[model samples]
Target: MTKATSAARDDRPPLLALVGPTAVGKTAVSLRIAEALDAEIISGDSMQVYRRMDIGTAKLPLAEREGIPHHLIDILEPEEPFSVSMFQSLCAEKIREIHERGKLPFLVGGTGLYVESVCYGFEFQGDSGDEAFRERMRHFAQAHGAEALHARLAAVDPSTAARLHPNDERRIIRALEVFETTGRPLSETQAQTRAAPKTSPYRLCLIGLTMDRAALYRRINERVDAMIAQGLVEEVEALIRSGVPQDAVSMQGLGYKEIAAYLRGECSLAEAVERLKRDTRHFAKRQLSWFRHMQDLVWAEADEEGKIDDLFKSICAIIAGKFHLDLEYIR
Candidate 1:
């Protein structure tokens, strides 16, 4: 455990989060960090909350978590809708419980907004969202591409789209849907909310992972292949067979959507794999863009091949300094 903190004076919950693009090995790094800090992981992933959708969501097996208790994973049925507000509320509760148990709350995932919402105490409108609109947008992105969907958002709400990554089709579509439904830009609505007393309620330490573009793309491709080998197709097939709608929010996740298409006979397995690789690459790029736009994130370069220990040490150093505590840098 880190030492030398003014913990008695500060009342805010301490939040440590690692955010980055998928396939950048956030999970691998997080396990070591969490073990060192006596932290319980609260999954910041948007897709990992659903049950029976493990491989496609890249959920590390419970046996592989090294005994770190994880929250917000596999808590929801596929048909049950999840919203940002729901996540924010649930995560806040988890943070408190972890603190009560005298352990650090570690938020780990590649989902940008989900992590950011918890970090900043972001408030949202009462609207739960239009699932049909979102499904239409997802279909549009699947048919045309993420960039095209982003361009549509740019046309409707350029300010929101400008900050959002092109491959962040979900948020882009949300921005567009907000415009279409309310005749108001989501950016403007957010601006109005910022005028309120809304602010971060936690003492957040955020670490962002980055890598060389080519290197990361290679990893993304390799990850897609690994998932295929790990029975990702079978996982999606099981989900579909179990009555989860193809258009369900859970089904729209990265690997699940592509593999679902294959299971539906919409595309050959080979084609789905290639598309998954390409789309995941695009998704990783988008994640990088989103994190860059995010403030207060300490950047860390991750190289899976060489200098990995150095990267871990540097990240530990950042966390120690940011939180004003000593870190052991050991599991």
Candidate 2:
């Protein structure tokens, strides 16, 4: 066998990834796969890490995890900041620990950047802080509005801007800062990083779930309604009462922000709920757009029935074929 082929078949434990747009049923499917493989789950979601931001993020509760050990959920306060670098570091450690225990590691979520960074071993070379520049950008955003700041990023890094929402002032400012400090568009730099030969560090099997766009949107809308019924407003109120700032990074999440607006009397509850649904649909679209650029993914179609058995069988087959895993343990 060729050296590359041999290395691909080396003793390193394989990493299985289940990713897709929001409400595509990734959570249920990942749990089943993890059980079948005797695996532990490492969350790829940016929002699910916060302690009390559960319902809106669609985070699986402990009871729903089916006793499978999950990493990175409920590990941070709502006011704390989290970044892709922190996720990458923590997830890598978890993968190693799972491997050491002879258990499979399943990276699961809809967050595109977090998943791709772990899959490709992205090197975070930029300094973690530029407090002065960050403050300047924040002031600029406040003075000119998020749209104007986002437009500035679009002028320099259109690809990055396209992926970020106009109101995502944090990322927009970061992208612009990357260009200003490095003299290159953030997208171009990231493309170069992804193109580097030593990118992927693990034997990875990426499984992506997709279905009819209309069906996915329907699910997203229903999920929003369910969150509302599940005391999402009360949840945000509790956080706010606990002193989580309205502009804190965690509060900027989809449901939290909209409900905060309602609680602040800036909009009616009905208006806020509708806006939340619309924004969630838009977010799911962006997720799909981002996943389209990922390489070497095995696609599975989630039917309307939501039966995970068929999908599980398909994924097991792919894992066996690509990673030469023994499936005798699965059943």
Best-fitting candidate, scored by lDDT: 2
Q: Candidate 1: give the clashing pairs.
A: none
Give all candidates' CA lDDT scores.
0.84, 0.86
Give the per-residue lDDT digits (tens) of candidate 1, residues 298-323. 99999866456788889889988878
For model 2, the superposed segments whose C-alpha errors exceed 4 Å read 1-9, 195-199, 326-328
Error of 1 at 222 (Å): 0.6
What TM-score would each prediction reach against the true structure? 0.84, 0.92
